[model samples]
Target: MSSQRYELVFSEGPGTGEDTVVVAPTGLAGPGGHPVYEDATGIVRAEISDRGEVRVLATGGGQNAVRVVRVRPLP
Candidate 1:
């Protein structure tokens, strides 16, 4: 499996530090190249796209807000 870091940016939505990023089960990958479904980050969730692009989802406080996912290249 492989590992990668992704930057979860809140483009449009509630103020900063208002929303939560939760881990969803979009059949994406994670730090390792494994089947990712969900995580225990409360409302803060994240997932990996098929192309290995990390897509984080914000929920709870900022669940209805828009999120910007940035995939960090392997170092």
Candidate 2:
């Protein structure tokens, strides 16, 4: 098997603004429509919905399950 590098950034949020998080992924990049893995922080994966809502998944970084969170910008 081969190893690839990826960065996960948490761009905007209530208090997460100006907070550009960088994470080096040890796994492959997740494809769209595919499920995501969750982390201990209750954030398994993040995706933007068709309605422009950011969905977050919560996984314990172990199991194959994921939690989802929705985020959107307010006007």
Clashing pairs in 2: 38-44, 38-59, 39-59, 44-57, 56-68, 56-69, 57-67, 58-67
TM-score of each: 0.36, 0.27
Give a tens-digit lDDT track for model 2, residues 1-75: 111211234544455544322222223334455223333343445444334343454445565432222332322
- Report model 1's TM-score to 2 decimal places: 0.36
Clashes (backbone N, CA, C under 3 Å), per candidate, total: 12, 8
- Model 2 / residue 38 / CA error / Å: 9.1
lDDT of 1 by residue, 4-73 (tens): 3333444464555533233335455456565453445545455665565554445465356355534332
How far does residue 41 in candidate 1 sit from its true spot (Å)?
Answer: 4.0
Superposed model 2: Cα runs more than 4 Å off: 1-17, 21-44, 61-75
Q: Each prediction's Cα lDDT score?
A: 0.47, 0.35
